[model samples]
Target: MDMLPVDRTNAECWQLGTDQITVLTTCAQTSGQIFAVEIRMPPGGGPPVLHRHDPSEVYYVLEGEFTFYVGGEGGVTRHRAGVGDVVPLDGGTPHTVRNESDADAVAFAVHTPGAVMEGFTRAAAVLGAPGARPTMEEVLALADAHGIEMLGPVPAQL
Candidate 1:
């Protein structure tokens, strides 16, 4: 219920596939209200599948550009995001944020329920070593356990 100041130097860092995830605030730290992680993604880095989770999320782009694909009542919309762009993703909407550029990208992935990021990053750690890509079967299993529903494969964008 007090100010939880986290120093960047002391924050825990982990690797999920090619992503460098620095957990700034955790679900336990905030009493399950919010969880946030800073993600450093390389070019061509992101999930291979379009997934939907229960917690609504926000992506604040700090560096580089990302192609955001989100599904709505009509259809999927492709958004080209760059530095300082903020994207709001609703809970239960299928989406994926990908760094399709030649350079790296950095952003804060903030989730309302917090369990989404917490479960995902921890699962990635258990799945394998840093930067290890999980197979489709493994991904499916993880998603199933974590309340995530896989919609389909990530589509190609221009």
Candidate 2:
């Protein structure tokens, strides 16, 4: 199969939580081999929950500072990453990321054998919209459909 090229101007952008995520490559575009997204986060922006999935994820911090929390059911480890830092999370490793600084942050995230993250991100964008509140049951269902499991809420400091 031939792969087509994609650029920022042609990518699909979504609002997930407080971040603007631009999907660069999707599973469908890569025949299920990989998926990538560029995320722009304002100060204190991040995912609503700490979660885990089957696909391994890598993050390249392009700008600003981000705090990453990674662990399992037992505990978590926190790391503060700045520009040019690369962070990798193994499959099924629970993790969450946030922009704790006063400045905005940009990061490129890639998932190998990209499961259903593309779909999940799209759905989350809609669900996270203003006044579009979804129940916990619905959120859990959505995550489950995408092979993700939410372990806890996002940290207060984030």
Top candidate on TM-score is: 1
lDDT of 1 by residue, 70-108 (tens): 888867788888999999998998998788999999998
lDDT of 2 by residue, 1-158 (tens): 44456767778888876799988899887889888999999999997568998989899999999999888565777899999999999988889988989999999999987857877888888887877888889889999988999999755553
Please count the clashing residue pairs in each candidate, in the order shown. Answer: 0, 0
Q: Which regions of candidate 2 are displaced past 4 Å?
A: 1-5, 72-74, 154-158
Q: After superposition, how far is residue 148 of candidate 2 from its true place, in Å?
A: 0.8
Instruction: Compute the lDDT of residue 135 as modeled in candidate 1.
Output: 86
Q: Rate the local accuracy (lDDT) of all candidates.
A: 0.84, 0.86
**Candidate 1 least-lDDT 10 residues:** 1-10
CA lDDT of 97 in candidate 2? 89
lDDT of 1: 0.84
TM-score to true structure, per model: 0.91, 0.88
How many angstroms is residue 37 displaced in model 2 relative to the true structure, after the best TM-score fit? 0.5
